[model samples]
Target chain A: MSDQTENEESPLAGEAYTLTSEPKLIDGRRVLGVVPGKPSTGESKDLIDEDAVMVWPHLLVRHAVAALAVMLLVLLLALLFDAPLREIANPNLTPNPEKAPWYFAALQELLAHFHPLVAGILVPTGILFGLAALPYLDRNAYLKPRHRKVAITAFTAFLGIWIILTLVGFAFRGPNWGWVWPWNEWYGEL
Target chain B: MKVMDRVRHSMMGRSFFRAPDRVTTRDVAAGHWANFFLHIYPVKMRRKEISFRYSWYLGAISTVLFGSLVASGVYLMFFYVPSPANAYGDIINLETQVAFGQYIRNVHRWSAHLMVLAVSFHMARVFYRGAYKSPREFNWVIGVVLLLLTLLLSFTGYLLPWDQLAYWAVTVGTGMATYVPFIGDRVSEILLGGPAVGASTLIRFYVLHVALLPAVLVVVLAVHLWRWRKDSMLDMERSEP
Candidate 1:
């Protein structure tokens, strides 16, 4: 009897506002009508309002302008500087302390410290796998900075390590892959 | 809407060239809807998705860099020969003789470097924003793949110049592959086509750099963008500071 009163008072007021077992007649017709449930806070789809501004002149225009700006910057940089093209590759005359491109400099630095397999292959593969695994490992939904303290810390550490290693490769390593400060005369001689 | 209207009224609009009456918002939506390529992006999006600070537009910058690289690379290729004997000489000729050739090469090189950086920064931004949660997880995985592809693209292109920088960098780069346990030597051999970087390696890298990798990146990027549209920027309701 209490259930009936509750149903009568509020058609959609509680957590279990699913359809009741008792069928009801509406305008002389029996119906399995909806007893709408209270909105679920956990559901993101319900919270998002689909009505949004159109993409044209908003999204598309901004994207176009940003791309154009990038192109212009590239053009300016291209005109101001020349791409380094050293004497045609002489395999017989290897440059001392030869370096891989800057992007790979960190991996090369890693190779300097650990076994090649560990530094070059294992660590890189691990990093990639870890990145792919991030979403699965941390399933918390809140985007607030306070809620994600640990994740933010771990990522910052990873980024800091990479930057440090890259700097070590770029300015520290010299001839015969030996350590030499960038300010030293021998550093530029290479 | 008003600006679009004036443009439609003017002679410069594409729709105006065809039919003056076909430039309304409904027509624009219909146009995007009917087209296969354009349909990947919805005609409407939450305004916050485009806000400058929301994403810092790093992804867009990376895409632009990639476009610049492709354009400059294709232009450079016209005067380049993949063979060992002619490759270095071809590069010399390109710089010394060809019009805008040096500029094009510069742009390609810089763009490649910039793309790698931009992609990294974009990933970092995504992570910092906690945008990888919930239904957006798979998209994050795809983003990782794209990042790997970007690195591979940069590495493979490093060899094409056939210069000292190109030769030794790739040699050292490929030599790292040889440290991978059982199949290490086999991997290096396959990559270089021999015990060392040579003609086979150059041609192989050329093919991968120019054809295979870019094609794969494009397909994966398509899926990334499509999924982004499907997911529509993680929890925009909670986006406010």
Candidate 2:
């Protein structure tokens, strides 16, 4: 009781408020009495509204599940498929199609259409720089899709074109980088 | 649960954990803070951020794939010698003679391919979520660098099998470097370590794949996660308004 009264009378008493009858320490600050109504500032309210949850069981458990799921996927894939291994590399004998890895398929497709400068050098450099500069270039404060139409549209368009190009290069192209029906003759290598 | 709690409360456990029993939120937070592994994560995050839809956990998926790659890559390394003479034979011998070599190689191959997909998907997801805004902008740049590194690592590893696919693919791939304006030839030569892909190129790619690039990625990834932790609690929506 004496400690409670002392806390209430102390210079820091106005900041120290209790939710219980007994005086207690929270974060090393003594609690006196509960202040009625809302916090003085909106900042505190916003923080409360954030609904912050502990990362331990909450986020960690989710991450663990995600990790396990991917591991299982890799394990299953390893079981089902054998990684491709062709004959020994010979400089003189290039494969008819001579494909880059699938991830670079888009660039290879572009190289088929455009000059080496445009497809090979400039386009890749532009894409990387553009991606890196995205946050700064599109300084729009709004987060919702409706609020940021132009950025979303532009990005989606690029992504679509890139995906299409990748598909063309990876599966739809045959010898001499010519178009082929993948269903008829599969040239894709993984 | 009881046995676990008892262990947690024991002197050795207490010393290891550097926190009391997890009876309260404070205790949990304390334990998290004390943990070296958990240091990468924030103590708290908004409820929405933890939901699967918010992130699709693509970043976590990419990381796990990378881990799988690292494990399988190390195993492959034990059997591989980075030379045209030994490289192709080693892969064949590994697939036939070595225990689980084919499976581990498959794991590495699939994980590499999946990692490329996951990282790219993560970028798209981040863009859609507008997660690169303001305070998170630099992390986005770091992510781009990571994406480039991932591609490079994959491309380098592609050549290790010394198969016809690898040889021609790299020939075509490095051939593109010759389009880089005035310095084109120089860049191509530096990358190939010769007029064409040969012994030097294999050794060069091997070192970069195993040592240099992975080291850079790990360091950059550490910074990326650290920044993520620091910015995790920021209310970007409110801050903008």
- Tell me what TM-score chain A of model 2 achieves: 0.75
Q: lDDT tens digits, residues B1-241, model 2? A: 7689789889998888889556556767888999998899999999889889999999989998988889899999999999999999999999999999999999999999999999999999999999999979999999999999999999999999999999988999999999999999999999999999999999999999999999999999999999999999998878655
lDDT of each: 0.81, 0.90
- Given candidate 1, what's the lDDT at residue B219? 99
The interface RMSD values of the models, given in order, are 7.4, 2.8
lDDT by residue for model 1 (A1-190), tens: 2433343334334544246554233222333445634434542334234457667667778888889888888888889978887888887998988898887788988998899989899999999999999999987777878887988888999999999888788778888778887777343211
What are the runs in model 1 whose C-alpha is more than 4 Å off?
Answer: A1-51, A183-190, B1-27, B35-37, B233-241
**Residue pair clashes in candidate 2:** A18-A33
Candidate achieving the largest DockQ: 2
Root-mean-square deviation per candidate: 12.1, 6.2
Name the 10 consecutive residues with the lowest summed lDDT in model 2 chain A.
Answer: A1-10
- Candidate 2 per-residue lDDT, tens place, A1-190, comes to 2442342334344554446444344323444444433335632333343688889889999999999999999899999999999989999887899999999999999998899999999999999999999999999988989999999999999999999999999999999998899989999999
Superposed model 2: Cα runs more than 4 Å off: A1-49
Q: B1-241, model 1: which lDDT tens digit per residue? A: 6677567568677443333333345656666666565666777877666778878889889988988898889999899999889998998999999998898988998788789989999999999888888778999999999999999999998888898989999999899899889999999999999998999999999999999999999999999988987777445555544
